[model samples]
Target: MQSLTNRQKRFLKSKAHHLNPIFQVGKQGVTDEMAKQINFALEARELIKVNVLRNADVDAKEAGELLQQKTGAELIQTIGHIVVLYKPSENEPTIQLP
Candidate 1:
């Protein structure tokens, strides 16, 4: 997927604002199974959030980047322990980019 532009990122950020984290990263870190689940979620939701627990081995940013690579989703934003991710759904795309 192509890199998201600043405007697109901003738009995704807003679109994701009302969403709650659908997954969490803890001591196990970003497992392959977790990545797969996230990938599926992105294909369905287009945008989603992941939360990093306080006891997580990796920080939010690291977890976000790892997931970004694994799921091929754009890292929209990271605030504290929350990681926002976005990807256009292949089957039925919902969120349109600016």
Candidate 2:
């Protein structure tokens, strides 16, 4: 997939406005298991939010980047403890970026 444009980022943020975080990174940070779960969720949901708890060993940005690298998902945004990720499904993408 190509890099998301500024407009695409804004569009994704709006689409994810009301969605709750599907995964949480705690003191363990972005474990492989957590990345797997996130990848699975992204395959099913296209766009998803992840929350990095305050007590997490890693910073929100670090955890988000780790997950993005491991899961091949794009980090759309990181607001406070929340991280937004997007990866279009190969077979059937659910979110159409602008």
Candidate 3:
């Protein structure tokens, strides 16, 4: 996977700020089904936010890493229970950076 440049990363972060999480990781957290859904979402939308529920035992960083590894998406940012990720679409991307 290609790494985002500092400028691109910053741009993506801002673009994702107002967007709500497309998927939520709850107590079950990062299940195989969840990973598969995330992968599909990333393919349709280049940038997406995942909300980690408070009850989940896993730390945010660990969850983010696992998601990145499993979905082949870049970890754009993580604040509180919210994680932002990016995976450029193979065809057309729904979200565009400035």
Candidate 4:
């Protein structure tokens, strides 16, 4: 995945504002299975939110970075415990970044 520009990130942030977290990171942190699931979700939705529970071993930012590296998704933003991610689908993408 290529790096997103500020404009694109802002656009994605707006698109993601209405979205709820589809995945959660707990005490186990980021697992291989979770990364795979997130990757699949990104392929379908292109943009997604991930929540880091209070019981998570790592902070939301850390977990977001880990997920970013594992899934090749851009870490759009991390607000509170919610981590926003964006990745254009290789097949048919739904969201078009500006």
Report lDDT (CA) for all predictions. Answer: 0.93, 0.90, 0.88, 0.94
For all candidates, the clash counts are 0, 0, 0, 0
Clashes of 3: 0
* Candidate topping lDDT: 4
* Model 2 segments more than 4 A misplaced: none
Instruction: State how far residue 9 of model 1 sits from its true place (Å).
Output: 0.4
TM-score of each: 0.97, 0.96, 0.91, 0.97
- Higher lDDT: candidate 1 or 2? 1
By the lDDT metric, which is better: model 2 or model 3?
2
Candidate number that wins on TM-score, 2 or 4: 4
lDDT per residue as tens, model 4, 13-77 = 99999999999999999999999999999999999999999999999999999999999999999
In the range 1-98, model 2's lDDT, one tens digit per residue, is 78989999999999989999978899878888888888888989999999999999998899889998999999999999999999999889877766
Which residue segments of model 4 deviate by more than 4 Å?
none
What C-alpha RMSD separates each model from the true structure?
0.6, 0.8, 1.4, 0.6
Model 4, residue 78: C-alpha shift (Å): 0.2
lDDT of 3 at 63: 85
